[model samples]
Target: MGISVTHKKLKVELVGFRLSTPKHYKIDGVENIDIERYDHEIFSKYLSILLEQENVEIKKKIDNCSITLLDYSENEISSYAFGKLLVFKSGKRQRIVNEDDLTEGEFKNRDQGLKNEIHFVINKTTGVILVERDYEKIFKASLLNSFFYHNKNFIYDYVDEFNKLNYNKETKTSIEIHKNKLIYINPLPSQDLFDELEEFARIKRFKVTKKVEKKKNHGIDGCAKELEDILNKASNTSLGQNVVSIEYYMDERGKGLEMDSLKKMIQNIYQSHYYEDFIITGTNIDNDLKTLTKDNITKRFEFKIPVDIDGNYVDICILFDKLLFLIQEYIEEHFDLDDYYSDKVRNLIVNP
Candidate 1:
């Protein structure tokens, strides 16, 4: 919840904007401001006021946080297109690529396969800031874009590091031998549950051939069950009960998700990727999310959106107090999937 550095530039984009006429309420600051009227002056002034409040809260959170507004001309906002490379702590800086870097293939936010692509939006009713794009796709691609394909474990490496900050238990490497020969080779310093499990499976001769990896999709078990089956083949070895498994972390219907704020301090703990999606819903959902320990907010932005699916309207309330847990959970599920093709399903990666 503590802050160090904050974002300086603010981007206003209307790329995927769809502003339908308000049916029930009128916009403030400008009299009778409706979708039909489309008063740019009144809307701009209202947005400035919101930003001013955010700036005040940001200054209070960080001693010397600085923020500046981007003055985009009318034409610029209309045809908004650019790279959004970013660098997190311990993360490599992403670079902007020329048009030649693009290829034909399907991937999340396949926005020309660019590493960094940022998009922002505002909610009409609540004035909350929102994003429709996959912030996670661009963020991960920024760190480790695939020349041919991606590895789910690549992103999990960073997510595991972040989970360490809260997980009280510490892990150290242990070497187990049978007879005089090396029967097991569970090794290394991290002792990350998944890492150890992956190696443990390998030690039991669970060979995950690269061919199976290229498959488009698998069950929640992914190739993990295949590894499990291989491990079962070697009765000489037994996996620890606590070993991480390739089980679906979220439910098939995504019933146990919530949202809250964790702020920039999360960067210090889990300096890898930031995913912005909202799948948690139900009454007082925001309150359920904030109940986690050591939660805090230290950013100047908001996201609001209404989703209409099958004629049902759903509103997402996000206050990101502790999100690394959710991110870790998603990574666990992704472990069973092809790194290149595991779509986040209803994970609704939202950014606010």
Candidate 2:
């Protein structure tokens, strides 16, 4: 019988970092290497330092991790390096079946292992690093910062310029969001108080007195007193305006309600002009759609790349190598080189 293999689509997203060297930095005993210059020697030395037992710790808990370089290639514009970072916990005790007895389990406890791998790409010239968003649990911006900080001889440092990945009205990339995943909302007034006051001249003008209680004593014979009260109330009553600028968030569980329900609620808030911020607590995103605007985004949205997966034990290093060039191409097509060198981005770097 032939074994059946299933193929599936895996979504790929990468985060970018602006690479720079601190002015005071040095490699080994040599003087500071210029940020503009890079060669194989510098890359080799940097990788050696990270492979050290002491320098491998990405964090307090992940100290036993190991890193391996799988492939490297470069062009006139950029040099690409692909690698795998492996984290494992050893000495886990578990019982196994004894081959001698079919019905009986292991006589002695044995060590079982737990492992995780994060595949990444580094573009030397662009100073951008790419890793899938799914591995966010094991890989984080702070973790990378801490890892680089662990080694003094590591010549290059990275600055995450994710906000630069903003999209305009003309962008072709599609963005999808779950209304249920939205956990927070902040609404700011878009109309001025004077705009609300203009309503006085437009309405019956006497409806404003609807809130006034019945007088204790009859002071006027007609609606003139009511009209006076209306005028006073209309002048003193707080004016309400519509909210335009708004923000939304997702909870720890990454869950939320239906988009239809969210839209209705927003419409109500916009008209009432009362509510501001909200913390929605849920643990599910049942459905998703491309309904959010750029203003509602907190982080630059993840870029989706499609990958083919085989239903077998995967060689992640090989897989990442194949995808590295594709990711580099995506970066080249979407990001502007000038943005990385802009004064604003430079100030964001530690040594600039």
Best by lDDT: 2
Writing each residue's lDDT as its tens digit, candidate 1 over 222-275 gives 323224432333223212222222211223454432111112222222221111
| Model 2 regions more than 4 Å off | 1-4, 10-13, 24-44, 52-78, 88-113, 133-136, 153-318, 334-352
Measured by TM-score, the strongest candidate is 2
How does model 2 score by TM-score?
0.36
Q: Please report, in order, the local distance difference test score of every candidate based on alpha carbons.
A: 0.24, 0.36
lDDT of 1 at 152: 25
**True-structure lDDT of candidate 2:** 0.36
Tens digits of per-residue lDDT for model 2 on 1-352? 9998555545555444433332222223333313222123234445554555343243333343323232234455546666565543334455555566856564332232344565666665554456543342444443454344444333333111111222123543212111111111112222322232222221111111111113422222212221332333332332223111122333335433234444344343333212222222222233222232212321222433334543222445545655566556656775566654563423422311
Q: What is the Å distance of residue 134 in model 1 from its true position?
A: 5.5
